[model samples]
Every structure is written in C-alpha cells, then in structure tokens.
Target: MKDLLTTTSSIIVILFCCCVLFLGDDADQHLSEPDSEMITARNHKKFLKARHPLAKTTLFRRVQSVRLKDGVLMFVTADQNGLKEHFFIIRDKNVILVKKDAGDMPPDSIKFDADGHGGIQVTIPNTFELDPLQDLLSCRN
Candidate 1:
C-alpha cells in the first residue's frame, strides 16, 4: 500500500509539472497583454469618470458603437427615470453633446458619413435631429 501511494503521488506531480510547463508562457502572455475589448471597456470607464464626475441620476446607459473610420465614439446616457436619452460624441478626445432625444422611440441604427471638409457626420435613425457633429464639447456629462 505504501509503494502504491508513492507511485500515484509521483504520477500526479509529474502531470501537474507537465501542464505548467506547456501552459506557462501562454498564460503569462495573456495576463500581461489586454485585448482590444478590455482596452475599449477601460477607455469607456475613463470617459464616464471624466465626463460625469458628479452624475448620479444620469449615467451612460449604452455605448452604441465606436466608429472605425475616425475612431469616434458614441455614447447614450439616460436619466434616472429612463425617460430621456442623451446622445454624445467623442472625437479627438473631446466629448460633445449631440442631442437630447425622447426615450419613447428605440434607437435602430447609427449612420456615419464623411462631411467633405475632413469631418464625419453621424445620424441616428428614428429621429429627424441633425448631426451635431460640430457642436461644442462643453457638456458636463
């Protein structure tokens, strides 16, 4: 019985060592480098912190999408009651207040287009609001 127990313990130790050797490098790399999704989430959290320092009732409900063309970010905020939706655009690291839209209509999609003068236009569906792409970036969340 003693010999058998020793053999089993040695086998288990060998298996564990093998696993660690084979998986060690990949595990270290994964831990050291964060993926794009993690980076994006971190950036969004930072944006919220910087934009809405004193916000309690109003906070970001959804980050619709991030524009790939110009790396622009779109965020939607809702009041505590969720009765109003506030749209915001982040470009060049500046957060711009786009519009305060009604919450009755659900947002379908967002369209992005070039404005010919080195700017991009954003259009939210189900609304007739113009693209406030050039709006001031002075909103306090």
Candidate 2:
C-alpha cells in the first residue's frame, strides 16, 4: 500500500510539472479571454485616451465599427445626450461630425457648428488623463 501511494504521488507531481513547463504563466492571461479580445481592448484603450482632438466626448453606448482610411478614423461619436448612428471622422486636429444619410453615401458637408451634431473645435491637449476604457469595462461587468 505504501509503495502504491508513493507511485501515484510521483505521477501526479510529474504531470503537474509538465503542465507548468508547457503552459507557463501567460496561459493564465488568456485563460478567460481570447487573443483578439485582448488586442482589441489594448487598441481601444489607446484610442479613447485623448488621441483625438475632441477629448470632451462621452460614450453613450457601444458602437459596432471603427475604421481608418487615409489617416482618418471613422467611428461613432457620442455626447451628453445620446449616441449617433452616423460615422464621425477624426483626423489631423479635426473631427468631422458627419452623419450617414438613409442613402448609400454619407453627406458631403455637415453643419460645422457645435450647437448640434456637426462637430466641435478644440486644441488637442498635451495629455489625456481620463480612463474611458475602464468606465466602459465596468459597465460591462
């Protein structure tokens, strides 16, 4: 009985060591989330941290898509009121708050005024300290 117990313990220890050697600590990092989610979260964190000119924007709801073309990023823009179903352009110290019409293409020129859903003008600050990523994550949890 004693010899059998020792053999079983030895096998268990060997299996554990093999698992630790093969898996490593990084396995725990991806134990819950997949690789793509981790990459997306990091990118989202970088974008929301005042990379754009308009740091005053608020995240009303979760938007689906964000694309970049010709050095410009097209994504949903939100404010204190609600979310917009149109695409807002962010590029080169400017945010073109243009909305997509019911037709195929977006409007050529939106009203460039801050009174409504046009756009806002501001100087890009040296640093952006807000953590909109954490705020949005907390909402999910």
lDDT of every predicted structure (CA atoms): 0.47, 0.45
Best by lDDT: 1
Tell how far residue 86 is off in model 1, in angstroms.
66
Please write out the lDDT profile of model 2 over residues 7-64, one tens digit for every residue: 9999999999998977876677678566445436548766455344433444323333
Q: How many residue pairs clash per model?
A: 0, 0
Residue-wise C-alpha lDDT for candidate 1, range 26-74, written one tens digit per residue: 8988887755345376497765555333322222333343222233344
- Candidate 1, residue 103: the lDDT equals 61
Q: Quote model 2's TM-score.
A: 0.20
lDDT score of residue 121 within candidate 2? 39
